[model samples]
Each structure stands twice: as structure tokens, then as C-alpha cells.
Target: MTAPESGDVWSFDYLWRWQHERGETEGRKPRPTALVACVKGANGRTNLFILPITKTRPSDDRLAVEIPQIERVRAGLAADLRLWVMIDEYNHDFLETSFYLDPKGRIGRFSSAFHKAVLAAFVQAGREKRLRKVPRYD
Candidate 1:
């Protein structure tokens, strides 16, 4: 399989805020996670920045982007359900050696426009000091 690209949604064992705070390194369950960025380090290791997608509505304190129906279909998500991409926080993992990311296969890719919007939102959150990075790799 080729290396993962931005906007590729995968079923990943995502660790939540509560879980991460309690010193838990493992995620509770597998969920749809969108690959927002892929950066290659000097050692040739790819660091994947992924955001979790959920049907749950974001709280006032959380910053998220609502997934359009067409975008949901493009990403191979359930079009019937209202989905939101949490941009205020993300999980960072290594594409090459992640125990959390198996070679099962990705759901699909989001449209370039939607994917760019997600990235923009994430950056804004970061600049506002609202972005949380949940490290999935030690």
C-alpha cells in the first residue's frame, strides 16, 4: 500500500481527552479518523496528524467543522448521520510503526476543498492556543 495522504479517513483506535488525561496510552475503540497532515522527518519517518470524526455535536468550548452531506459521502462516511470533524485537537502517530494503524485499508478521501478547510481550521485553532495534540506515539 502507498503512504497515507491528507484527508484519508481510517478506522483507528482513538484515545479521547479523558482517556489521555488519566495516563492511558491506548484508545478505547476504533473510530473514523481523518488524516489531516503527513510530514516526513529527517529520518524518513512519516508523522501523521489525524483528527477524529464523530456524530456528537461539539460543545461551545470545542471548535469543530460540520461535515457536509456530499463531503461525508466522498469520505465514505454515513451520509444519513450528521458528522463533525474535531479540529481543535488531533492525534499524532507514525504511519510506519503505529500499532494503532493496521493495514486494513482507509474508508476514503475527502474532497480537496473540504480537506483544506479542515487544515485551515486546525491551524487557526493552534494559533488561538486551542489546539490539543494527543500523541499516539511515545
Candidate 2:
């Protein structure tokens, strides 16, 4: 499988496992996520850093960036879909596992401007101490 490039949107099976009010539970949820970075490891596997993309608008604009409806449509999403890139919801996975990049699930790449905005949001999150540090990909 090819490593997904930065700005490329792909469907991810995000495993949500956490200790809730009752006890620990897990769910495999499928969603579209933007590949923000792909770092090749020494073992020849690539580690993918990604941010979740949602169809719902974010309550905090400072933590998200809106992807224009037109751009979303061009990326193979619904024409009327309201998409937002959630910067705070960053996650990582190895290319050999966890991530799925089927052609049918790809939503295409975002514009350079949008990619920059996503990076800026990461910087903001770091400055606010919400994010420890931004991951570097070679």
C-alpha cells in the first residue's frame, strides 16, 4: 500500500477506547481523516500523522478550519456537506496497519492554502499547551 501524502483524505477506522463513566469500552468508528504527515521508519514502515475531518461544524473556530463546500465536492464528498478539519483531534498510525487508503474511500487532497491553515492550527494548539509538540515527517 502507498503512503498517503499530506492533505490527502482517507477513511480511517478509528478505535475509540476509553474509560467512561461506567468502565472501559471500545468501538471502531470509521471516518475521513486528513493525512498531515507520513514519516518513514527505519523498518521501512511509514507512520502517518492525521487529523480528523468532520461533516459537522466545530464549536471552536480556533481549533478547526472549514473546508469549502465546493472544495469538498471536488474531493468526492457530498456537494452540500459542511466539512471541518479538527486540528485538536490528531492521531497516528503505521502505514502497515490501522490506516485504509482504498481508492473508493479517498476524498482527494486539500488545497495548499487549506493545508497551511491546518498547520497553523497545529502551531496554535502547541502554543496554547493543548498539543505538546508538532510531529516532524521526513
Candidate 3:
């Protein structure tokens, strides 16, 4: 997919499955799977996807399995060890507050913040020679 714009539509399931399989192989923990339904704007970028909350042992039951996934995503994109902690904090906040956001602004502010956070993480990771940002299509 050409870089998503504001209005470009993408699938949630595709990104979710991609993250899940990638997490299993390259990650140290299990992460939640995602599925894309549709886009709400014209920017053609990453957007919200469903993450059904599930309670599991040794993990917070409120956030479901998303914490691991968010952390993995952060770590996968982290260039330096410093980002690990920062990303972890951001991940925690995202999972915790996502439910309280006004549905109307989620696509714009909250979703954009999530995407920006990940992008920053990846850029840092790439700059530190941790990984390369490969173009992917969903």
C-alpha cells in the first residue's frame, strides 16, 4: 500500500495479524491481534482497530492482551534501550486511556498520537542501527 493518507482505507485485521505473527517470532511475549474494518478520514494512515478485552493470568484483566502487543510494537521499533522504557510508558497509557476517549476525536488526536509514537520509536530504532523500516502493504 502506498503510504496511507488521511482518507485512504486500510484493514484492521491485516495489521493485527501481521503484528501477532511477527510478535510470536521476534517478540518475547504474546500480543493482541488486530483487524482493520475501515478508515474515517482522508489522511490514509493507520487508524483504530478492535481489541476485544480478555482476562488472562499474570496480566491486567482490564486491558486484555494488548499491553504485550503494544510493548512489543514499541520494542520492535526502539533504536536505543532508553526508548524501551519510554515506549512502555506510552503503551501503558494508550491501553489504559483508549476506552475513555470521545469516539469522535479518537480517529484524529488519539489515533494520531499512537501512530506518531510508533513512528518516533521506529525512527529512533532505525537511526541507532537496530532495524530498517521496510515498506509494507496490508
User: Who wins the TM-score comparison?
Assistant: 1
| Candidate 1 Cα errors over 4 Å, as ranges | none
TM-score of 2: 0.72
Candidate 3, position 99, lDDT: 31
Greater-lDDT candidate between 1 and 2? 1
Candidate 3: regions farther than 4 A off: 1-3, 6-9, 12-110, 132-138
Pairs of residues clashing in candidate 1? none
**lDDT of model 3, residue 16:** 26
- Compared with the true structure, what per-residue lDDT tens digits does model 3 show for residues 38-71? 2453654434333221223323311122233444
Model 2: per-residue Cα lDDT over 1-138, one tens digit each: 444787787776543222222342322466877777777989998877777777777775337778888668655666677888777656666666552445466667777777777878876786787742222222
In the range 1-138, model 1's lDDT, one tens digit per residue, is: 656898899888988876898999998889998999999989899999989999999999899999999999998999999999999888999988888886875889999999999999988999999988889887
lDDT, model 3: 0.29
Give the lowest summed-lDDT range of ten residues in model 1.
1-10
Better of 1 and 3 by lDDT: 1
TM-score on alpha carbons, each prediction: 0.95, 0.72, 0.25
